[model samples]
Target: MPVRKLLSGLIGGMTPAGRFRHACRLLERADHSVRGFARLGQMAGSGMVAAQYQVACAYLDGIGVPRSPLEGMRWMHRAASAGHVEACFSLALMLLVDPPGQDGADSLLPTAWPEGIDAWPDPVAATHWAGQAARAGLPDAQALYGYLLATGPESVRDPEAAGIWCARAAQAGCPQGDLALAVNHLCAPDQPPGSNPGAVAALLRAAESGLPTAQYMLGLLHERGWGLSPDAAEAEKWYARAAAGGVRPAQARYGVMLLRNGRGNSRAIMAAETWLRRAALAGDREAAALLGDLHACGKAALPGDHEAVTWYRMAAEHDHAVACRMLALLYIQGRGVASDPDQARDWLQRAAVLGDVAAMTDLAATLLDRRDTPPATPAQAAAPLPDFRAMAQAGDPVAAFNLAVSLHRGVGCAADPAQAAMWMERAAEAGVVNAQYWYGRMLLAGEGISASPSQARHWLERAASHGLPEACIAAAQARLEGYGGPRDHAGALAFYHRAAEAGRGEAMFSLGAMYGGGHDVPPDRTQALHWFTRGAQAGNALAQFMLGRYLAQGLAGPVDRAQARHWLAQAVAGGVTAASAELDGMMLADDHAAP
Candidate 1:
């Protein structure tokens, strides 16, 4: 007879307790049959602990029934409450992994649940059940309980107790127990040097058992030489294994190692790129930055600049300071994208805000030369001044120069010439070329500091050596006027010529005057007229006036009254009063000649 039929006949004459015992026997004898499962369910409903545990297992594992977590947890809780050891461990494990507020049978546990506690992990409840199973000599439960005690909430943490439980589990050959021991050892503080013997041994054992996290930790130990001689090859081997097992940090470290060891090898570069891209996509900023560098520099025959920009932008968006600056450089240089000063400035500012000192200096230089920048609203204009001042105070030379200019011109603050001179001199001493020129001018004019012709000439020459056009012109004037040293007309002419070739309108006018007046050279009216014409076309008011006068008198070449009038009108529009008076004289001459 089938076990279910035999049990049915035997239980009819028996008492209630005898019938219950017969039901348990039938459940065990009928094993995996559908009829046995049906009887087991009935017995579980009637408060049989073993039957409830078996029914829970069936629902959880989808054995001869439709799997349902709600039914599984309900029955598991019933068995666990009735002191089934395996049932208690199963319930704890389920509760430990379930997301907070989503535990299937939470409402059946307690009535005094704390309000607003859904955000916190309910490890304490899981620990309660795991403790009973752990004390019952379940190795897995011992390891879990020890880990929870070691790493759970402050109220339940007891490292000494955790160590004892983990030692027992480890002796029973549980891999997780070894991993827990390693974690505790690594996290211990104030350990004596060379004291990580247990951690290294435990990590090696766990890693050899194919644990990905243990493999990564073992790699770190080898790389850092924590408890052994540093071994790059050993570290690489472990990291490679962990990376293959999908450990993200291991992927990043493995890629970096491959890149370092395989420089100039195309196969190595490609392999490294694959792992780095994986880690970068998983939100590793360091990995993203390394990927950007590889592609940006055309490593492994990759399309360089465009791909670099893509990776750099990814890292930069996450506030990687170096990536932000590199992206800014790419934009400014038009590498793999159209040159956009605005985008470049935006990234540079972001990098500076992230405490990149080099970015702060570069940003200040870019802002100081925005003569053609699109107009911004008042709010946009005023927003960066405070930050600019801070950068200046933090010892950025270009920032100091920009702040001085801002103070002198009253762009974002009151005009303070004294402060401007002070900052300009500081920046000049710091080797800022523009600052050298401006500070020299301030000293020459005594605008905010005592006039010192000697110091002025020295700074002007310093700037002139760097080929600054304005500085050349200022240095020439100092030589011609004997402000600092003996007058040297030859030196003055040379400086004027240098500035004129660099397209300084003021320098062109000066050269024209020197040639026309025969200053330290033979008179050359033709050369004078040539420079004056070039200067006039370059929008120099004095050059326009001189060119008009020369045209009217025919001093350099043939006279042209119409051309003279045109030049005179241009000069007058440029605010040269002498040109207006000359135009009046020409009108009188025309009237006299017509009559």
Candidate 2:
């Protein structure tokens, strides 16, 4: 026999009460036949609210019928209008929570029912039914009505009325009601101090009922001393509980706390790493970044380099600027990855766009190095090159210096020495030592701006004080030539020696010339030869030419004719006109003496 026929025959002789009980029993069984439920629904009359509600639940849950929310809602509405409290609450929830579908169809009940709730959700109807059930002392309805009254649309929101309903639900032992009331009190800035105790009590009730959000809130209260004394131990306990319950923020906070206090405890360190990894996998950005740093530094027994790269890449993909910058450095240095300048530059540009100052400086330097090369991809070609002027205007000193270099060299921009000089001065004023040296040199030479020897000397001196070798040499030259204030031979000698000791070829050549000419100290042929050799080895053309001539004439030491010719050849190749002329003369003499 078909199950529906069998169920109909079995219930055919039962009284109305017995039939309702039979239907409820069938609906409660998970394996009851759909056809059986459909027959029972047909038998349920409008007056039998219990049977109607049970049949409606079967259709709503697809328990024993062809799931038809429309049929279910119609029966539920019939029961609710007939004063069934649970039925009214169910109907209210369906109307309030289920939204209408895109084509104006009711999402909750797709099939048409002549007397269903509505084609679209009706919050007004939901509120009416919920109020009716709530007034009948239903705890769930009371809590839900209170929440809706406080957070519903403008016309329905009533915070004071919400409080009354919430209190009623809380007194009936509703955890959600207690949690909401606690949150309301916590959010009210004008609440009296005495209200905090009530809020804490409510939160405790909710937390004790195993609500993860309430537990997390309690942890925060203890951690931040919000209406309570700050108790790190208590906070950690609550955080651990909430984190185990899958609260993401609690997971992150607990992980950080463990890591901070796990210095000498191996167990705590491992626990911290586990929690941090869990939080990071759950999409906590701070947890991911912190994990990256720990791995990068090999902190708490983490594997370095390779593991750091993995975590940093994760955080960088999430748009963490510091992580992007760190990842760029790793790529540039081949730390746990192949050395890839392009990849490094790409990461650097990403970080720079995210407002990282160090990234901006590094990115500018990289761009300048590759300015002459063709862009590697269409995106690179289409992307407008970094605008140095814009960055400089935004107050980046490195950008100002880069802009000056670009303008002076006509690299990706028109050559404009005047503008370059102006930018250089700006960079110098911003305390860039290299910019100070270059700006000072430009001032002395009057390359773009009017010459100001005194100002040039001041800038050069400032740069030299910061230990710039080039600045030391420039400052020495200014003093030696009397271009900046009166010539000071002693000061010039001191500055030249300082730069030469720092391995500056120009300073070495200057020191050799001074010794050979007896300009600042007693003439010392040996000292002159030593300085000239050092400068020549450093590739100074003038020094090479002077050393070659001296060797050819045996003025400073025993002549080595072969070494003299080699030095002269190097000088000529380096574009020394005097060296070229001297070599030509030697060749001419050799040709005349040929037998």
Candidate 3:
């Protein structure tokens, strides 16, 4: 039944156990002639226990009732104290979950009731109640105590004790305990490493007994080549049984498997998608992320979907890091949305706050360049200061390094080289690569810390070891020039290659110069032109000048006058004085040629 209808039945002046018994009688035609309300109204202790459990459900759901888990637990306690089998089962399930607060104190129940008042759920109390239920042929309580003994989590598992309880429950037709033993055998099977034949036999018996979990495990065993020969069709059959019993993961697996059987089923992806959505809705975090990715990529035919975005947004709201980063990027690039730099920065900040290192880096960059310029004021306009220091202090390594940069450069905050060095030191220690490079700089120059070339080289080496391009470039330059150590041109070349791939404009220009002049590398004007053109387009002034020279001399690719003039103009604009002079000379020559 829908939970709403169940709640209404309770609120309409019907007792829980009475209603259950009535429903069972009506369904089964067991012909119990007890007057429903009269019997309940005249009921003694045992009868009230049913009403208490029903009222507990009403309180728990708040559908035609007031939502109150604590109240539910209280009533559950009442029924449990009366030696109710269902109440004991409910109590066991509730205890397995988080405890509800009681009497204004943070705990589940008031230290147990019914079994042993002063010693509730203690070894003795749990054993006594569980023993009574086990002997009385109750299934779930037997399953619980059997599990405790079988796993030995709180106490040692007496296999003999476990066997006795499991046998009783199995005889009572409780599939769960049998399934539990089956699972225990599957995981540890042999007492040590290899497969346990005894455990496999136990699982097969449990599967035959209609235990859904066992069926699923048996499906996994067949799906893999474990104990059984690998068989997709056989696995699907077991999975179907588990799904029929309402196991969420099994439902998903079975649905996807049926979908994949393409002889008649071409809707495998769709079926998988539906099951994934169901799992996501049922509070599976990984399912939410997977569904979001499918939607985002259109693999689920959900193109241009904010449905995935909404899922991600919901997950992010619930504090998922990957979801936070996804939202952060959407805001950062203004993808299919209005660009709001502050909102972008805020999202990035949230991701950083959640300890995402990449998000921290992006957040630091955004904070340092906040486009939060309120329209040019008629009064003095104070510069927008980056506030990533707070996050840095909160232990974000990237934020720490960024805060240090702001302090060192006075970009968005006051210049305090000392503080900058301190934060940079912290960030470097925390494993941020660039922080190591900058930390080295501070040590070398005595800009923030005491000057020590050796310490500078040490930190630079650390950064370089991690393949930090900028650090590599700087370290290679220092080494090749014999500033901190002996010249190593080979190291310089390797560093240049690393920096160039990372899109460093100056490194590309330097590589082109090396190739063009054949100073250290073999002369190759074709390669030089390629690097020079790439660097020039990226706004490197020297590269622009070099590209213009190559075009004028026809030393690399054939170039038209239009291309040469464009590069010359760019070089001049970038403050290359020689390019400016050459532009004037070329203009004079062009005028002379025209005359």
Per lDDT, the best of the predicted structures is: 1
Candidate 3 lDDT tens digits, 101-189: 54465433444443323432344345555655666668867876676566644454566677667656656667777765655554443
1-595: candidate 2 lDDT, tens digit per residue: 9999997797788887886666666666776655457557766664677777877787777788766777777888888988999999998898876533434554554555446455447787787888899999999899878877776666887788888988898999999788777766665557842257877888889888998888988898888887778998888989899999999889989998897777647788789888988988888877888888887565756556667778888889999998898888666544556446799899998999999986887676667668789877887667655678888988888789888878877877999999999999999999776689889988988977999999999999888764456678888888888877888877888888767765677888888898898586678878888999999998899899989988877988898777888899999998999999887877787689899
Scored against the true structure, residue 77 in model 2 reaches a CA lDDT of: 89
Candidate 1, residue 488: CA error in Å? Answer: 43
Whose TM-score is higher: candidate 2's or candidate 3's? 2
Against the reference, the lDDT scores of all candidates come to: 0.81, 0.80, 0.68
Q: Residue 53: error of model 1 in Å?
A: 6.3
TM-score of 2: 0.51
Query: How many pairs of residues collide in model 3?
Result: 1
The clash count for each model shown is 0, 1, 1
The TM-scores of all predictions, comma-separated, are 0.53, 0.51, 0.46
Pairs clashing in candidate 2? 34-64
Q: Which pairs of residues collide in candidate 1?
A: none
- Alpha carbon deviation, residue 440, candidate 1 (Å): 24
Which tens-of-lDDT digit does each residue in 431-502 have in candidate 1? 877789999999999978999999999999888765567788889999998988889888988888767765
lDDT of 3: 0.68
